[model samples]
Target: MRRLVDRLRYLGPAAGFLSLLRLTAAAWAGDAPKGEVMKHRFETSRIFPGTVRDYWVYVPSQYDPARPACLYVNQDGIQYDAPAVFDRLIAEKAMPVTIGVFVMPGRVEAPSPGALDRFNRSYEYDGLGDGYARFLLEELLPVVETLRTADGRPIRLSKDGNDRAIGGSSSGAACAFTAAWERPDSFRRVFSAIGTYVGLRGANAYPTLVRKVEPKPLRIFLQDGSNDLNIFGGDWWMANQEMERALAFAGYEVHHAWGAGGHDHRHADVVFPDAMRWLWKDWPAPVKAGAGSPQLQAILIPGEDWQLVGDGYRFTEGPAVTAAGEVFFNDPGAGKSYRIGPDGEPAVFLEDSSGADGQAFGPDGRLVSALAKTGQVVARDVSGSQPPRILAEGFPPNDLVVRHDGGVYVTSPAADPREPGKVWYIGPSGGKRVVDSGLRFPNGVTLSPDQSLLYVADTRSHWVYSYQVQPDGGLAHKQKYFHLHAPDTADDAGADGLRADREGRVYVATRMGIQVCDQAGRVNAIIPTPNGKVSNLTFGGPAFDVLHATCGDRVYRRRVRARGANAYDAPIKPAPPRL
Candidate 1:
């Protein structure tokens, strides 16, 4: 009877919306078994202050309280008689025995009758942040762990992400995705039906973000219909399609089914059973993401492999590209710097590099470096003239960036222990002054294309700080910071090197991968390294679009849509009308 009502509600929606609703109804009904409904409510003071969420747990007869069972989480409360379906599927051995937890969004009750309670649906379900995921893993799941099955089997849940799955519809669908995306190590399988991947609560930015981030080990199943909502937020069907396209572009293990129905759960019901099977098909074997996207493939040559550029060094830092697309990096520990020419050959660029850890090229055809051992900024012309000329003296410079105006800004990490970092400006007249201070382990620094802003990466924290560049070579409003996150990793969010493209995409070399942030300071995508730790990166090639990364002993390259902020952007004068 409930199934029939669900079908009727789905059919009432627009033609395009019916397919999704119908499929959901069928999927749920086909898998559900005949079972009794059970309900339980509990309150805990351990969660966010004054916030209480009502959660429903479904237990099937096939669940043996004598042993632990797999777990599934459904956002937006429980639906489709999940317990019955689990019982049937487990009894027939069609699916693994699992305990289902359906949870409702939290609400903060009003202090008085005149005031209304603050419902957290949109805040918890639609937002593209990790607060909700944190709430679940740290608070909700821990509380659920205290409970036991009817047979007294201590409900021991698997800590492995592969053993966990999350599913939902509409806004709940978005919540499910945000959870898995933010914490892929917690949930690896996702089932989304008629997902609210639109503008509501910043969900619309997901498509673009998906394409930019490094691929994670996640398998997603998406379903939506043409007749879905076409309201102020966005067209649900269109958003889902865009998500599918972005996932494919990023080489994610994504599958989708489109129908001619509307925004309800009917179509999802029909597909739910199959979606479950697909999501959990290989269980412990694990599902792997493809070899990145086409753009990534074009840049990374699979057969070429990562050859040892050089080794036996204390620390390798700073990579810069020349006009010929050759790369030169510093081996600070060995007090030497090597260059990799376009022909993939390594040669000594400078044996006495003055203990250089960070290097870049200035527009005047000279290489600029941060000489940590000498506490100075130096510039050396490639013509192999005399030794490097001191551009500015008296500061423990860590990383340096050269502006088009011939000015230089170098980060000093040893300036103060409490603050530990400061950006110093070196005027074209050879005068030096402190631009800004109070940064935590500032390691990498770069300038925007127009030189309007400077980006600094803090290797000790998970934040990338940005500062506006004043015309007089000073920094302003330096508090703006962007987050760089990875799946349950250590504080290695430490971004070591920074670079930017014409489109304002900032790439920070980080521990888990290269975290890409857009103009708005949001993490758009992540580019993982074949090896985990990446110390630095730079853009090369004739057009300045090929990205080269220095990870431990290996170097990797990739192509991107945006062009690098080359020091020299002017057209070269024709060579004396040769003759």
Candidate 2:
């Protein structure tokens, strides 16, 4: 018995090592075509100044200069004889004629010989941001465009995301995914191997984010092993499985392969050739996403989806539409407000607008707002006249909702050390009274369709508190705080804004998409945004059925079955401006 147990332990390690050798042999045997491996050393004059990198390109033999070829990007340098596989696949008519670019991480040489080389692998590969993607789209690809194929055919890459793919392994795998996740317009299909979707550098958030974010048009293939790393960061195998499960739950077009091996390129080596086939399974035909989860279908229209209205903003928030169906939003970080006119173009509305957080139209035809800088509830007439009149002051206001009776309730989040966050009601006469207290990070205040209850979203606690509205404009019977559900791995839902439709469904903009709660305080459905970390949302368009979401720097909208509440039901046209 003792001998058998000893033999089992040795067998495990011995088999693992042997498997690694086999994978390495396979990789070397599948070397790319000699002329296909074209290397270009260039300096990026625009971004990451004083940085240089080696960009490797592989143009398939069938590529024609007259017709643009599909593009594929692999981070962390080249891998697994990609050129050879691409040549074979294109010849076999399995994938479109594609141009593959393998890029090495940036490096800064040490000032002196004694110091070590300033390797930027971890910095560029591990951080959670769009810097790496920008390096590829803005710097690397353009340089590749100047090169020609061995046949002297000029290289022209397709700009459509449907014709492009990006992939990598380990930390590079996370970087590849971050690129597509940050800028889906550049690359859509993804191939990840032994992916570092773990806690090394906030990569573990992907699983939770997948479910919370509105599903992108990306098609992903994940490869991992049962015997992968189990260390301080996290279990790579478990994280990979979690990501797959979340993707499945969110209705993304995702496929994955699980194996019994450790953390390395060995499993990926054996799988890369097959992964390429699957990543490009469909050629010019686009990949379609599956219907969202049942929880999501309730709020989101089955056929309606997010459409990009505009881009290039410092920080977009507080999306609201005017009576003419034109949208308006704030770029608080830039200290400017913009309006999307009927022509679909953005123009400045207000500059230096007191750092507005939330904006809504009141029944009286005035723009009601929660100004963070002034900590006041103010109302600005449409005429854009003298300084706005303050409804109430002396509290750090975050969001506000106007009741049918003309009173306003604002959320005061805990910012200063001396004050705890509270919900206050401001009477029509500008009198203030505290309604509720002792909640966590109150934000996104709204009312029920019947005007009998108020909903307050506690951003940090994953719960939306419901309060009964009394006749005198006070809250009571504060029971049934609906808990916002999310995967255990994610950070607290960043529930920042709230809106409601005529059907009495309350839409709470959360980190994991918008949680839709019915009148009974039950989560009837979820409406995901195209991107994660949506800051706020509002219903717009002619019928008020279009949902506009403020996701970081981008703004997206989708049509829905429910119609938004008419905040300004009695439209009283603003008095004509005096000359």
Candidate 3:
């Protein structure tokens, strides 16, 4: 009886307070102009595989089929009385003639009635990656466009990301943000309420990742109460605050509203009308990507971004820059090599490149290639006029580096699992011999700026081996020098390529991105690729300041603050790194 009385004491005031707020909000929410709502069932999805979902489309009465309507997508089949709000806003000319898409999460039917149905809400919403974004851009929106009104007017959504907005509450809110974050070219404005930004999935990494990568053009609004969920995943209130702080720290256009309400939608519902006003204010102006953290700002030049230099390749690797500031990369899958000249255009340098995996420019201006398919080391002229000069044969090399004196060091990892990987040395006279053996999977190789040390990237481990170069063209005193950062989703560092700068810092291309490590092997900064996968990088351009990265199927280049060290040039001792 005492416990019951205590519950009543709390419930009584809370129920009355919420009811009063709802009564006050109902005045405008009901009096607002109305929009036509059409419902549809969608059963086909290759992305979610064997799932069905229901969706609703809201078209404002003022919408004209002559022009594409601005878009708004709300997950979880819509909340916050969005249709009425959109009706009022459109009627008042506060927002454009917008159409809203309310989509439910996908579900798979069970074999029997007693069996549990498979739910994809958490997988599609809480989980990270670009899968859901692709579904929306490639599947959902295209399907939405096929719909027509009762009068047979086709629904056309604005193709511009600036005119699109997405919002939701709880897990739906996370899904909305994920859609915008992954495909900023599709959705630019986000409105989140009581978002699931905690550890329910990989969303826990957003706060950390947002500060590291280049910012995307997005305007976001966040809302959470102090009394939100504090369960096993994480504290909801704190997570939203952390996300807000991270967005601000990374220079994002973000706003927030805190409240004393608990983990319910009542407060969010009350504030929905005003939130819409702020989110869609100053329409038609594109959202700009802000300058990220100071560390990122230090390396990335102003007004410079990753520009696409080449595409249509199966897999690109072996990015090498020459003294003339031209970039050469190999497409091992296509068995072709391409060169990007000073004009930033890709030209076919070599066809049937003997399936080269890594390449470097030799002291004589010839391109030295590590031929993996034919098990040969060859050097070819830049113009593709002469046949390749086979320097060595019978050993399949993964990556190689050439010294100014014409000595070459190559990494040859065992194809089979049982054998150990080996590093080879070929003297200027072409005498090939094993320099060292026993690395797990030796992949990318490079020399220090002074040519006194050699760095070898072990793909199967999170370590980069550093070796003192001996006078006899062999390695001595090898140490696991640079420790790399691996992604949480994978076991290995996936370190593929490495390059050295004039400041003695090594830029390692891993699953994470180009991790710039100091001389002491401490990672000072991580520059992620736009696609989150980078195989190799090289410094090119007129001043050797542009870092060209060979990502999957494409080549991207960006101007950086540091300059690359040329292996074919005379060695110069660099200044000591900061401790």
Q: What's the true lDDT of residue 227 in model 3?
A: 87
Give the per-residue lDDT digits (tens) of candidate 3, residues 1-579.
343233223222223454344335545355556778999988889999899999999988888899999999998897887888788778777788899999999999898989988989999889776788788888998999999988788999999999999998988888999889878988999999999999998788788777766788999998788889999999999999999999999999998777766787766776676677778888877789888888677678878878888888999999887888888999999899888866889988778887998989989988889998999899988876897898888888989999999998999999896799999998898889999999999988999999999999999999999999999988999999998877655778898898998888888999888987778887666887877779999999878999999999989999899899988989989998766
Ordered list by lDDT, greatest first: 3, 2, 1
Report the C-alpha lDDT of model 1 over 148-213, residue by residue, as the tens digit.
Answer: 655565556676777778889999999999989878888888999999999877888788767766
Error of 1 at 281 (Å): 2.4
lDDT (Cα atoms) of all candidates against the true structure: 0.75, 0.76, 0.86
Q: Spell out the clash pairs found in candidate 3.
A: none
* Global lDDT of model 3: 0.86
Error of 3 at 294 (Å): 1.7
For model 2, the superposed segments whose C-alpha errors exceed 4 Å read 1-35, 42-52, 149-152, 307-399, 411-423, 428-430, 434-443, 448-496, 501-536, 540-544, 548-557, 563-579
TM-score of 3: 0.86
Location of the lowest summed lDDT over 10 successive residues in candidate 3: 5-14
In candidate 2, what are the lDDT values of residues 165-254, reduced to their tens digit? 999888898999988877887788999988898888788878866765556778899888788889999988899999889889989888
